[model samples]
Target: MRKIAILAVGFAPNQSEITETISLLISLSEFKAQFKIFAFDRSTPLNHHELYDLESLNPKDFDALVLPGGIGNATHLSTWSNDKIKMTVNPTVEKIIKQFYEESKPIGAICMAPIVVAKVLAKHNPNITLGENFSETHLVEGWKVTVEKCPSTDYITCRDTKVITTPAYMNDATPFQVFTGIRGLTKELVEMA
Candidate 1:
């Protein structure tokens, strides 16, 4: 079975992060993949499955890596502003990402998580999307729900980098749409493996 390492950036994080990780997990469950949650925090939601600390994980052990969005404050941990401060993604995460890339393993990112990946692999110039149409608000009946801008059920892959990304909740998409996009990303990531 192929092993996948999932990092929740800052704990199973918020609702979005939890949902995103679970969504990815559910998607990957349909394949021949075994996964472990690599949380930034010391504690994670307890379950029959075991958890590992991100700092202690080695990229060599996992076939692929997945990072789900929900990094509200942890976003400050990464710096993509310029090359001078290229020391982003914290040391552990940076090393993990670089090692995966070096070994030609696939990596997947969803929603705002792509920023972290792009920032870490700035030199690679990864092709990613955070769900477009942010310029317009989605208006619906009953409530003023912002117009749903898409790329919802679609994903982007950086062929050279072997990195896959999708716009999960980035466009305020529905859970079904988010899951669809995530499933697509997971499919591509597993294929690359």
Candidate 2:
């Protein structure tokens, strides 16, 4: 089974629903995957879901890394909430992203979650998006990434960085459209893995 690490790094309750949606879709796919939902802080669990401490996560153990949607990730896992251009990504989050990136492993981000990845891998300048006219387009300014406006049910997969991104709630999309976009993310991620 392929091992996929889903970062439950945000504080928003809806973030869990998005992550669970990704998990369920992946579970129903043909590729068999074992997931580890990691917590940035073990002391406070989100929605009572037990999370594996992120400090103990080893990038070498997983085939792919997933970052869930919700702007909460930008606020919590990264400093994007306050400093959009000069934001700083969490050390552990940065480490994992770099490791998976250096290893050429797949990394998937949903909605605003791509902000953290784009910030961490700024020098690499990969492509990502949060739909057209994203309210926070200013955040991508100094990140050095090429931002594209993909459809709500579509995703952008950077072949060079192995980074897959989708605009889930980032766009004014329906639940079905969000699920479709995430499903595309999972299918592409597993193929890359």
Candidate 3:
């Protein structure tokens, strides 16, 4: 049994974090049956099987940590540029991440979740820019239904210097790209355990 941690925040991009997290967790079944999914925000929706707080979580107990995609992950759980001041992730989560790093634990973050990864890297190197690509719009039927851009880092750093990131979306105008996918980390992260 391997313990895995998944953070869920409130008010995120539809199908971003939830879909990705569920997919990653399901894929983990190939490795182990025991899992601990943690939802950080009180407003977050939860499955009966998932846990609800960081207070009870011990980084040592888990073999790996996964951060999923979402606007919430971008804006709240990662670095945010605001009014010339750069802000980073929730303090508690950051602390846990630092601990995970010290122990050389595997981490998987997708989409905006990488911003947190960038910050973690900065703590040591401070020279890495978590590159973000703009102009990636969600278009459909030749109509730009939604404009999507990562205002922060998309590649998250993990133990052994692993970085997992993606830029995926579905629509007629916004065609899919192979680089914009999530399953790649499923194999990498789960295999670490």
Best by lDDT: 2
The residue-by-residue lDDT of candidate 1 on 1-193, one tens digit each, is: 7888887654444523766767888899987688887766645563555667778788888899988876431353354323222325677777888899999999998876776666677677666775775331221111211122347788988888898988788776788888899999998998888
List TM-score per model, in order. Answer: 0.81, 0.89, 0.68
Candidate 3 lDDT by residue in tens digits, 1-193: 6676765554334424565566556666765646676656655455555456766668888877777666666565654534112555678878877776677767676655655655655534321112244332211101211223332313232334444444433211121221234455655666675
Off by over 4 Å in 2: 10-30, 43-49
The predicted structure with the larger TM-score, 1 or 3, is 1
TM-score of predicted model 2? 0.89
lDDT of 2 by residue, 9-121 (tens): 64455343454345434542556777777867455455534579888889999999988787567777888878878888889989989999999999998888888899888
The candidate, 2 or 3, that scores higher on lDDT is 2
| Between candidates 1 and 2, the lDDT winner | 2
Give, for candidate 1, the lowest lDDT window spanning 10 residues: 136-145
Q: Could you give the candidate ranking by lDDT, starting with the highest?
A: 2, 1, 3
Model 3 vs. true fold: TM: 0.68
Candidate number that wins on lDDT, 1 or 3: 1
In model 1, what lDDT does residue 7 have? 71
